[model samples]
Target: MTSRRDLLATLGTVSLAGFAGCSALPFGDGQDEKSDDVALPAATVEPISWPESPFPVAVPSTLAETHRDRARELLTAVPVDPAVPNSAVAEELQSDRERAADRLETDTQEPWPTQELSRWRDRRHAAATVRGTYRAATGEDDAEAVTERRRAVRDELSAFVSAHEYRASSPLEAVLVHAPIEELVSDCRRRTRPGSGYPADPVADPFQAGDAVGLVEFADATLADARGLRDAYLADRSNTSAQWVPLSDTSEQLQIALAHTRSTVQDFLEHDEPPFDADLDGTAGRWLFTEASRRVETMAEEHDVYRDDGDYARAILVAGRTLAAIEALRTTIDGINGDAYRDEVTVESVTRTAERAREALAAIDASESPELAAQLCRPALDTVELLPEVIEEGYADAGRVQGELAWAELYARAVPAATAFVSERLG
Candidate 1:
């Protein structure tokens, strides 16, 4: 009966400690200066060495010979596209970047003077002036206006800092820039059109525009790191001989899968269901609700396979969070007892199907046989496939069911095509 939080906490404690230990050893006393010197033979005193290049010298590769080509292939497979930018997510990320630029400018322009108290007082006064201006321009209860002003302030600060020729002196520079940017992006992408007919509350929607942006950023960074590693390994590939390759072909397979998953999720978010019932009440709500449930179930099933891989945890977390949000929406639909909302019964039934799919996912063990995992995943997939029918039947009104039916038709057509593509590639 351990909760997800409990499991995550345990995993964090164990995994982090294990990784920390692998990174370093206990420090010891400094070596004697005499021991560091090495005497050259008298015959080699003139010291004739290999010619140095005027350009940067290429370092020899460090990886074992067997892994060189595999590493190359992996590096080549890294996706280069910046994530497809959603305007809302872009705005959030830009705001974060501006904030960092402002902070950097302020710190550089008004560094501590000789007198601590004087410096502190000066900073306080400057901050107060800025605050007064902000408040005057954006009154209380107007969050959007406040946000825009904050962004403007940050942009101005960044420009000032850049003009001042201040260099990044500490690790905090990158931290300040990357952390907020990542967070804003994650938040913006979480829910698509928050108040859409989807049964889930806008607050609880799983897909954050921000998270999508962050994932793309993370993937790009990982690819860069991998490419550097590959280049270094390949530089010395000729001299080293090894029993087994250090880089596996599986890296390419995993990258392709990740790219596909990102694309699929993005597609879902941008997708617009055809106009259904004129009323945005029960019929429309039920259709959107069922679609949301099905999408969540599909994503959860796909993510379950990669739970064991450290890099895939973000995807797994996204899927789980989305599934939980859909579940909550279902609960909300069930609780709507008013006569006007009777059509929401479909939302309840589809939600049960989603829960069953989630249960199947929880039962799956990545460590188990691949065949078994695939078998388990099929039932979950089947459950998702049933959602369209549930919506179509429950909302028997032709106009109300149009959008839901179209999506279901698309899902049915696409799944087989996708399956065939995977089968052929893997076969």
Candidate 2:
């Protein structure tokens, strides 16, 4: 089982790279709506156009494969490295030809433009969706400009999804642009003050956006083949699935579920069956792309939930470390006082947890929001320093834990708070 300490010890240390570091260079972590989540490749990480090579086993595209050609063209114009264009910016893509060439490079650079560009593109796509919904609601052809723009946005969305698919991860983490109907059948309303940090006029509505985005039940299968291949590779490398993924509690459960999910996908793919059929009709194209985008968002959320779930589990495991320290401190203090009450006390257990806890605290990005850290994280750390003094003085008994009662109470609160904070962010 990977305990909290063990996980931290190995994070960001994996020799993760694509095809000898040249084919698909490490790029952006993922850029979606909220958070600086990485999306596709960013500057310093370029996608590699794989050289034609025969595989021992044929690699046949499946599921979204029918629309794969357009998706592949997303990076058509992306060169090995893009030259600084004449102007630092170009208002919009010059043409389809120019767009294909510069799309990938443009997304990977300029103060990290992927998220902004994606949001812009999604907003443009939304314009079409809104119009489509409006026309569906009330037959209106007077909006010819809307129809033309809608088609334009539909094409743009197809390109966006193609770029997104190009960046899909092994577990099939989808790079979603925005939520389903929220981004699609959204109201034609804007903020009175765009950046004033106030609520928008419409507020937040849910039912207004039902399964406005479809093709959802197909997610598991879509990600299955990709995930199965990854799992099979890992198992092959280690010669056993157990060794490749040796986690405990929920972590282990999720891993096992992944194996099952991928295997099911593999079975379906091998049988030449798509996990789910998307409505590919011209009328359904807009909805199909919207679902594609929606899946990306859904995948991003699921990935985050899975990751945070592990962190939460890890925190629970580490709380054991805290308890172990408390027990050790209690025993040592019992010996120190010689069966008599001591106002203050000291022990090695306090020091060990305190020192290690600092490392754990640091992992949570302590510098992020100094004020919040000041209130929540600082107190526990401050208590660490006081432990030795209290122990030496044999201060007020902290019951079974020993030393100061405040020390135990402080840590108990702080540790869980940190755990909750990690989960909140994940949600």
Q: Estimate the TM-score for candidate 1.
A: 0.21
Worst 10 residues of 1 by lDDT: 20-29
lDDT (tens digit, per residue) of candidate 1 on 1-427: 1121222233442342132121101111122122112221222111111112111113223221213233223223222221213445334333433432233233221111111212222222222222222222222222343334334434443443234211122111211122222222232233222222221221232123222222332222223222333344334334333211111122234345545554543433443441223333334343434454455555555454433332232332233233333343333233332322224323333344344434434333331222222322332333233223323223122222322332222332233323333323222
lDDT of each: 0.29, 0.27
Q: For candidate 2, lDDT tens digit of each residue in 1-427? A: 1111121222222221111111111212231112112121111111111112111122233322322232233233222232323222112212322433333223222111222322233222322223222222222232334334334444443443343221212111110111111122121111111222211211121112111211111121222333333333333333222211222243344434433433432332232211234322221122112222222233334434534533322222233223222332333333333422222222333233344444544443433333223223332333333333322323212221222222323333344443343223322
